[model samples]
Target: MFAIVRRHPANIAWIALNVALLIVVAGLLVAGSRVSVTGYYSEAAWNWMAGQSMYDTTGTGFLYLPHSAIAYIPFAVQAHPQGDVAWRIISLILFVLGCYRFFRLSPQKSEFFNLSAGFVALLLCADCMRNGQATVIMTATMLLAIDAIRRENWHLCTWLLMLGFAVKPLSIVLILLVGALYAPMRWRLGVGIIVLALVPFAFQSPDYVWQQYEEFGLCLFHSNRIGYEKWWAQLFGMLKAFGLEVPDSIQTASRLLCAVGTLAICFVLKQKLDSKRFLVWLYTLTAIYLMLFNPRTENCTYCVLGPALGLFYAEALCGRRWFAAGSMMALAVVILGSFELGQHITPQGVPPVWLAPLACCFFTLYAAFRLTSELNRLEPPPSREAQPVLE
Candidate 1:
């Protein structure tokens, strides 16, 4: 086990690189996350500070929870010194903790490695630090749950999932889908989720909580698709161009098809996927999650594309993939999702007419192909050996 950890070039390189990225990009992300505390989260946060009822702030443009905002207590409309400091502190903690969980999820020998270098890797990936929000909390808690699963510590996994859900509902999907896919971790984690989820309601003012939930649901489905062009529109739009009349039905089916196809490819490949392959899978899944299940996502949501870039670079170094496509798209995201893009404010609605669904189609297909092969790489011991391990 120690030899394996020693063999991790990723960790050794990260020890040096991670600190630099955190000081640079992570710093930027933290600032970005806090910038427009204006939308729903801001409104609710400000209102809550005023000792008024806290209702759904989604319409105000806060898709995820105002984790730091909430903790700051009492509305952000009038800033207090302690409140501001508290917000920064929370963001820092979430950022560091998130880095820890992610590293632990990687190859590690001891719990100590899980605690230190794994976190360093996370900080190394620290792309979303400045504009951190509930997503920070979401990523941190949920990844911890995932790490716990890898450790076979269901008790801790449950607590992490609960912590994640309390920050953002969608985060629960990480715990649910991944845990279920890796089924053995189910029992304790699932129970922890249920209890943690329900326990919150007990203390939260019913009216306050219900109003927020109502707003979340309403804003969720009722929202317009006008933000950025739906990434899936490319394939569907191409089919439409041929007069095939692709509808939401086709959209749903396509996503399912992608999932099944990716899984099958992984199963068939049956090899340990290098990081680049993992990137392809991450991109494929993220693309589907955002385009199909996201219901409402915007340019800003592209922050996650960093992980894809990381994987792509890792793979490229291995002479596996060309850097052009990932590079260009990543540049596009950095340009669009960045603070600089806020000034443009062009009422560009969804169906991102400019996305050239053709581009999207090719990108999606390539990613799916990559991910499937990666999955096939993960090997399990034969049944006889597996039984003893399970026991």
Candidate 2:
């Protein structure tokens, strides 16, 4: 191991940087559990073990499924600081490993690209790590599932998708999008769904499990209805900052329409591109949609798009698209600076919470144009008559 570390000095430095950041953030949380979202997970697990309802009727409490609480039991059973540190360490490892695997999926591989992209993603997500948000793990699972799909490892893909959904229900966007676009995933998705549903019953009484499921649906419903009242860092917030207030009904309709549009784009691309490129495009679209449309999207939620952006940046550099690469770097800077930017008042007289969404909007348009140009440039295969005969 020492010899290997000496051979790859850059890799060692990168890993050390991640560990240093994790230690700083996790150390802070050890003393103040109030700031970290892991408190919610711990509370939910405690409640489940005590036969109490995990769902918050007011739409502000624990938002994940009961099975998710079960997943947190190990951490919940431990005392503060220790459990918090353990959870952060696990989250950091999953995220770093997932990013490494996903970056390797790029058609062109370079150590510099991998290290730079991974570092940028980590910097952009530092706040999420400090807050102990489950979004970090959910993002990791999404990256791993995409890599699994590219490799045609359907069994692993199914488990990863299920784990993502259990961590954050919003992951349904990626789950459904991938299932619809890939034929091989259909049956595996069905089996995974069944297993996820049945797992809760095995641990708890059927009556209790069924009741929690019912409350889970209601919890989501209430959350969606009230989500607009807060100052979100999503499309609605971006619009409202400009004096255009969207009603709750319009918000719901817009989300549905965009979901359909995403599926249509994926279907078209699946036929035009190779399997690997198509998977990357699918993940990109899913990540963008989640950031812009998820009703409760917060600034920290932008972590979901960090890995996708990193992949795009590396692709631009490999293909010699200097302009595109520069744009990606600029977007990363904006995202890293968004919290600071939000401190100053904008021309609209509101804090610039809209900065991240605006960047996402530009990225969406740029990605569409790039995809269209690539498709137009693709050369068609020659027919047999047009090809020269071989001796």
Candidate 3:
């Protein structure tokens, strides 16, 4: 069955063409002519082109970096109502493409596995698209970057990572992780690319760019202090929701400790394994960490974890079948039941929050521990042994 699918690229292309048409029609039906915050992205783009700052106080203010506005420029130039719909439609397309790219780059070899992973990935992204969030674009950027890393295309990897970083600064963590895997050589290149990417923005407005950095930090600080509903889904907010009074000081300390501990474990694993094995663990772990540790991780941000979850599930199933079933149950709880579960636990008028992602949190750590268990005896991980299904 899988072989038949593989042999028919023409069939796949035709299916894709029909799917794209359906996506456009569906987007038009669901979105209508309403312009949401994604329009603010276009607003920021137009304003930037007019010599105004990207972070100006207009229409829900663009929280992204200056370079990120460049991506919205094409849509921004379109007329108002059309531009708004165009942005959403483009975002929808990116979500589909991102899923396809993720499956292709993933370690799930069979077409059935790839198709299943793609389905799960899109299901995970459903909320993100409904809200017209840029998280899908960020997901695509990460998927392509991972594919580049697998091909050892260091320059392509650097550029893709930068593109994502411009939208979601948390992506820098993944960039740093990749840098470590390739060590001194790739590290220099990755860092250099980041620095050079900033150079173009600096040329646009050196002083304003610096000030935008301050504004960006202040924005993050304010959002953290607010403790929004989405924040409740993250480490600090989860603690608070569980009746633990985590002060700002403790929260800061806890985040630092966890981040350092995660990195330390990854570094030790790197020493024990070669590039391929190390990358598999590194990418999966870092994806989870980006959402787990950060206070800004909203429901939409959870879309980024879809690929990591798929990778972990594949690895688990290949190893201990029972463990695979358990993880799937946990994931089903997260994907299907988390919202209602969160609503039942919280009071009226409060945003829905869930503790199920915490299950994923623990599973990530367990996966890392399993991967790095033989640090004392440095032989390659057992042949055909199930590591993370990350390419």
Best lDDT goes to which candidate? 2
Model 1 agreement with the true structure over 1-391: per-residue lDDT tens digits: 2332354555455444545544554354345544434344556666555545454333435554434236434435445333333444465555455544444333333444443333322432343343434555565565455456556676776777666666666564455455545456677766775565455356456666566556656655534342222332334533443445546765667757765664554444323554323323433354335433443433333333333333333343334344644553444444243333432432343233223333334445556565555455555655764445554
C-alpha TM-score for every candidate: 0.59, 0.91, 0.77
Query: What overall lDDT goes with each candidate model?
Result: 0.46, 0.84, 0.64
By TM-score, the best candidate is 2
Q: Lowest-lDDT window of 10 residues in candidate 1?
A: 224-233
lDDT of 2 at 322: 93
lDDT score, candidate 3, position 239: 62
Point out where model 3 deviates above 4 Å.
1-36, 56-60, 80-108, 184-214, 227-231, 315-323, 329-333, 365-391
Residue 207 accuracy (lDDT) in model 2: 92
TM-score for model 3?
Answer: 0.77
Residue 191 displacement (Å), model 2 = 1.9
Error of 2 at 350 (Å): 4.1
User: What ranges in model 2 sit over 4 Å off?
Assistant: 1-6, 31-33, 318-320, 347-352, 380-391
- Per-residue lDDT tens digits for candidate 2, residues 277-320, read 88878888998999999988878888888888888887887788
